[model samples]
Target: MIKKSIVFAAFDEEYVATIEFKLAKLTEERASIEFITDAGCLEAFLERPKKIDVLILPYGIMLPHPEAFSKTSIYYLTEEEMDAENPAYIYKYYSVKRMLEKIDSGLITEAESEKGTKVVGVFSASGGTGKTITALTLAHKLMKKGKRVIYISTVPYQDFTYYIDDASVLGTAFCYQCSINIKNALKIIQDEIKNEGFDFLPSFKNLPVSYQMKFSVYSQIVDYLRDKNIYDYIVVELSSELEADKLVFLKNCDWKVLLTTQDKIAVGKLEALLSNMLDFDRNILILCNRYKYNQPDFLSGAQLLQKYEFSEFIEEYNAPLDLEMTKNSQLFDRTILCME
Candidate 1:
């Protein structure tokens, strides 16, 4: 969706910080707010008559030239009084819920909807099932089909970086620092795209385990990319061990692909995981990697359906050790084309 441009004029430092914190909780990509702390800066901005969808002014702030913003939608942030006639006033210390309600209710001008970006997540219950290969090949295939695609590895230790040779990996630390500002994050991503041939956000290998578990930061980075509407598709590679926060991130995705092998242990673990995750049944697709048609199955398809409540098993693809060979083959044809 296109982001609405909002200009907030508040001189108080404490108030500005509170508003910033409130704004960070907003989930929709409807508005992009610009905060002005100095009164002079606000006045100067008003004098120039910038193209802004919403102009938020502090209660009782004197406007030297109110006529200049005649075309702009003006709202007052007041706590003591709310004008009955002009109901465009919001409480200065309103909760984030109320603020979001106001924005969704058309009291605040809404952002236009642009072309939506699709997010696909690839996950597994255990490691070494070719999850990274599936994600990377899907991205390469989508890009080859003339679609803008970015591959993000959210796995711990970021083993996926070794597959993409000669690319400068943007560690999780850099992402956490820059994630506060969407524009700054976009600049970094653009610079990386320019230097590297492909679009990717590398793993956070250098970060401590505690820092790496900040799933909100990871979600913000993905949301920034989606809101920017820069790519047609985003393929996310997740860690095998799915925590509560990781499940929260997976629930936000448009599609979720679960990769598992025919090993009895892997299938057993997957069955246990699926029993607890009944909500994702509709959007989740179970992919059995490295299946041989002639070989007897350790975990049969019927058993998977009966045990895990899966609708059906997706077609299996041969596992190729050579990354280049896999990309050139039809390994990702069914998955990528089906998504489109």
Candidate 2:
């Protein structure tokens, strides 16, 4: 078995260098990666007789003879919105994990029969970081951006009735768990899917039932959704109660958004969470809530995806609050999809 060769060419060494550094440490994949900053260097490398399985280049760097490398998979990197619709172009500025996925961009296309959907796990180390709100808002934002999105809250005891409409599916997810085969699973999921502005699984009847779900069940659900190629993103609200050590299913997600606050205890929890994050250090996006107060000394200079210092906080979850009517609705955009 021959190893695949993956090469990246870009004028900005600093930008591409960061990606190279992250992927190198990510894992020892079955590929040889070379980053070329100079066009002459890339030209000389291309002159080699060795196999070039994949080549990623910026849009401005045109290839004189593209047909020469018929066997090579070429992709263009860009940051502009106009280029997003192109199949050959990938978003240049993205998290390492997301960048890799964009390298295989076919997996996230909306077209059926293609590899589709990205799972975003919204998690927090401490309470009151508004993790659930962030997850629901992410789904809404992605939907508004013309991408298909589904929200799933794995909080166990209750559903996301506060942020979304509570049209019950009458224990559809429970039947899915008991399903024996993929056909049954698909039929059960499709039969019960509810669209509350965006698609979502109601998990259970709109009741205060304590139903504990395993990570394997969630994994199967993700596989089923990806198999259908109907969704662009799956926003999962992971329970913070699972904590850092017990988050065994974290790796299943493509991106993990960890919400935090200026609270001292939250900082300690983040420190613990960051300790075992060797696998997804670059894919973990940190967002601060009530950031007007202050940042913890540890994350003082860290690059945050977004920040909020709301003048008013929703202290109670007993009432259903309409997030679309709130100021935070403007907090999300297509840019929020980017990791790191």
Candidate 3:
């Protein structure tokens, strides 16, 4: 069954209600619709603007920025704005909608790779190594390059959404709540490549009960994405508990980065994780997060490399994690990579 979504936008209270009534009629046919009036608040509107297929901007209200209306299709009251001496309001809405339609339609025929999306997946030995922070940093760095990035986290907490300055959550975390079988999930992702220019798909809300059962689905998704050659990169912030099937999913990436610290406990767990993956790829990069220069007890990456007999497969990077800097810098119009 094809489920439809709609957004209702207008200023006049009675007119808004009338449109809502019409939207309700559409819902009788199983359309998923939402209303965005002065009451719905801008944050709420922006959070789910795509749900609105047709946006009916009402008469008489003035907007502060022309850019605000760019996310949807617009229908304006041609004479209502003129009568109220706010022709600019009508003009702005029309302009924004027209431009969005142009880009949206162009996406249908456009090639995916030309759009330039970079995706990087961030994994860690355990929970506290700042995996989400690192993933957001990679995304922020790419966005700064004037490239589009979609940041997604497989972990339940999903702190990635907190770091994005002007970002919106793309798909629901509880993907399984919908009709998201493994096949459909992969299809939606590939379909969005040309449509959204660049976007991210977070892990399903509930990890399937049996890891082995999910592989065929994961493989299908990865194969589709790899074959399309669309995104410059897709960053996956992985969960801590490493499973065999999940590791198979990791191998599909261009780079499967693992973050670790010099703490004996941390490095030990990372070693164990890598040792278990006998077929681990060569591209695995070991990042030493929160490096301490003076603490001799805390081994340097090279020293750890020599001690662990992992000098062959692991390349270490020393960079201290700065949470505050990550938060503030993430807001700027671009993404930056700081190597120490």
Candidate 4:
């Protein structure tokens, strides 16, 4: 594949080097990077440019003539007000990952790449169904199996303070802000994120502050993440409380894992609900979570993939999965096989 040419320029050589290293790591060394440490060299290079796909430079430098690099998408890096206002200005103060994400997202659709991303939506009709735990365990297992995995949580007022330490890790919120112009915005679903060696956007600050905008910002981000071909598996943990957003998100998933309790009395209602709503998708899988050996597999009319009874805390499953250590590997492997 022909890699895109990216030229990043700044006055500080150390800062530029950090960005270069981070960008190369993030892109898997698939991008061609050119750095300019001297303002004189940058100006000289701008005098006669080649087929550079993207140009990002300090906002302090005077922008080159528009016709100089006609085919290039130019971005100005700024710490404060720009010398000249432009839509392509990127905040210099943001983290290196965030800055690179903004740059990468700009040209997301330009490259023709194959996607390995498979979205798994963990949802439940009712709460306390082990939805979040299931999602996290699945992500951990997939990571152990050598699949690039990310977990996203959409619970309102969530605080994974320990998981995400940086208060400045505003990936979800920043991605939402970019989604305001969803049409012009790159067709990416989630901001490229990492936490605890398990990729994820941190918990939301004031989740979905705009209802007038997209129904669920996450609904689109997951789809974008898949199309971008970044990760192999994307496990999303959604709140059972929000039905409308759940519906919107499930459409993008390759496999939908819906959890429910062993309530035989709720059978008729669940059958009608799953049939009327989720029956449209063949990939939907229903599971009776926290099940004993005797709990009915077909809690409703749907097929079952029940989670065996467990006494250990959910955190016990945090480390790399050892198939010898547990029985849930059966569930994890089955879901992965379907995705593969």
Candidate 5:
């Protein structure tokens, strides 16, 4: 007898969940179920799984950049073929059920080969800078502006929660309630966005420093998002302090922003940081966070723009930084996010 398998390409979150629920109802049966959200997970899963039986694909998965469908048994379910009322879209629900039955009866063996996902990493170069704030702010802004955004911060101290305080937190408790785990955090983010349209995920929590995260894990998360077209923007925040893992993540970001100030030491450090990114297609945009013009000689924003050729990218105007908030609050509620 041929081994049995199940494959699905879920486009939006609702459809993914609907399929998952239907698959769950079949738990009493002996067949094993392997669900894939996007091409990233599909490729990653295919690399490790012993065998594959049924392949279900999201219609939009291969549409963005047609190269995605090169060698996969999966086929498209065009909009005309899909029906909202029918679980299998445009086709009759039982037709899909019968197709699965055929697979279980030693009909289909393996799918044609296909591609993987793309990723965008975000990192910064110094301490006491606004790396986390910038990541959170940009992700939040994108989401509010109607784009799907997945905000992630690899810093273990957990600052993302505060930046998106208005939204319900997806913390340990929430994950437990939903039966989710950190290893699947990226998948969960995909699921949330697929269903809810946008979401955020904190870095792996409660880990001892003895085992720092490998860059591979970060890459996997980035690939998952890219493969699924899960979000319009993927904003990542690394610790302001440098580390091996930090460098790994920075190299992966499509555009790297170096947050800095006019302080002599900070400026010197930033110059050195730029020297390191010489070969990458990364932009070293300078973010002047919590700035104030206290001295007569201090350049106005425009003058700074001319002095610093890259200053044109300065994102927003904000009140001076409050040293107190930086040191005392768990929320790290900066004046910018709090702005009405």
Candidate 6:
């Protein structure tokens, strides 16, 4: 049986939380729920990137263009008296069970999935170039703006758990081994990784396990997440070492961010690497981290861009060495956010 997909768009956090809590009681085999609290995100979601079986919005919230979502069945939750003749109207502040009953009565219909999610891959030629930091910071910034974002680290030696407390290392690995459906896998992820503000899937637990899993399995997991239409963005932090498997995975991403430093050796490696890459201009952005002016020995930003013939090159300002401090700085606001 196909699981019913439901989306709740509302401005009240408490109301959203209550609905989420109650929905968690339902079996994953029967239903899936996605919540949207941001107005912008709600608007984007209503665009119907994917088929939404039911969309719940509070009556007070203004939907600028109702006709645009004529394909989506909309239900208004109102505390005051609603049009008794309108079957789409549900009494607000009702129990979760009652609300779900209204949904089950066939107020909305489900359709096929839509492709709208964008996957971004952050990669570097070498370690210690702030690839993971950049990925996490970008995800955080998007999440701050009320976008549904998830971070996935494909590094063999997992360090993402250390930086982000309560992260579920090898959560995806568990799902893969169990051969769980995407709906159940998503539920497991939401339960395992809690209170992190955003979702994160860490690398494998050990090298042996990592080697045992094929690259195709990794691709399948990412593909399933992208097709689900649950998240707005998937930011991936890849390993520094490049292999055929890694390259294939990176190529599938919607966007690629190549991180590098001013070190001559690093720039040389990057230049040599980019020479053999095909279609490097499309959806690719090169970022020079820890940038400084009037540097000697190391290549300048303009020099690096000219040598590589890159379409887009950005100079990331040097920020505090501390991770927490760096996140609050202008680095992400001014540099990372500028990217599409």
Clash count (model 2, backbone only): 1
| lDDT for 281 (candidate 2) | 54
Using lDDT, rank the candidates from best to worst. 1, 6, 2, 4, 3, 5
> How would you encode candidate 5's per-residue C-alpha lDDT over 66-97 as one tens digit per residue?
33433434544444335545443322122333
TM-score of 1: 0.57
Name the lDDT value of residue 281 in candidate 6.
54
- Number of the predicted model whose TM-score against the real structure is largest: 1
TM-score of 5: 0.46
Task: Flag the better candidate by TM-score, 5 or 6.
Answer: 6
Residue 136 lDDT in candidate 2: 80
Count of clashing residue pairs in every prediction: 0, 1, 15, 4, 17, 0
| Residue-level lDDT for 31 in candidate 2 | 58
Q: State model 1's lDDT.
A: 0.67
lDDT of 2 by residue, 213-322 (tens): 45556666777787677888888888777543337566667777777776667766876766656565545666665454333444454333223111122223344345
Counting only residues 3 or more apart in sequence or on different chains, how many pairs clash (N, Cα, C under 3 Å) in candidate 3?
15
Judged by lDDT against the true structure, how good is candidate 4?
0.60
lDDT of each residue in 1-340, candidate 1, tens digit only: 6777788877866456544734643534567788999988877886787777778888887667878777777888775436534557875544444555664554333343236898899989988778888888778877876778888877766776666775465654356555455456655665544212347876554652545345565677788889888888888988887789888888778878778777777888888887777777655656677766666666565355553322123345454444586576655554553454
The TM-score that candidate 2 achieves is 0.56
Candidate 4 lDDT by residue in tens digits, 180-285: 6653334332443655456876654454443233445666667776777888888988776647667766755777776666666444444555666754355665
lDDT of 3 by residue, 1-340 (tens): 4544445455545334323443344235445556565755744665544434445455543444436556545545443224334322342212222322332333122222234333355788676777776776666555444455655556645555454443444355234423446665564564333212325554343344422224445445545565576545667777787777667777656566677767788878877876777566445656656655554434354443542321111122364444357544422111122110
Estimate the TM-score of every prediction: 0.57, 0.56, 0.47, 0.49, 0.46, 0.56
* Candidate 5: 10-residue stretch with minimal lDDT: 331-340
Task: Please estimate how well model 3 matches the true structure, expressed as its whole-model Cα lDDT.
Answer: 0.49
Model 6 misplaced regions, further than 4 Å: 1-115, 171-195, 207-211, 292-294, 301-320
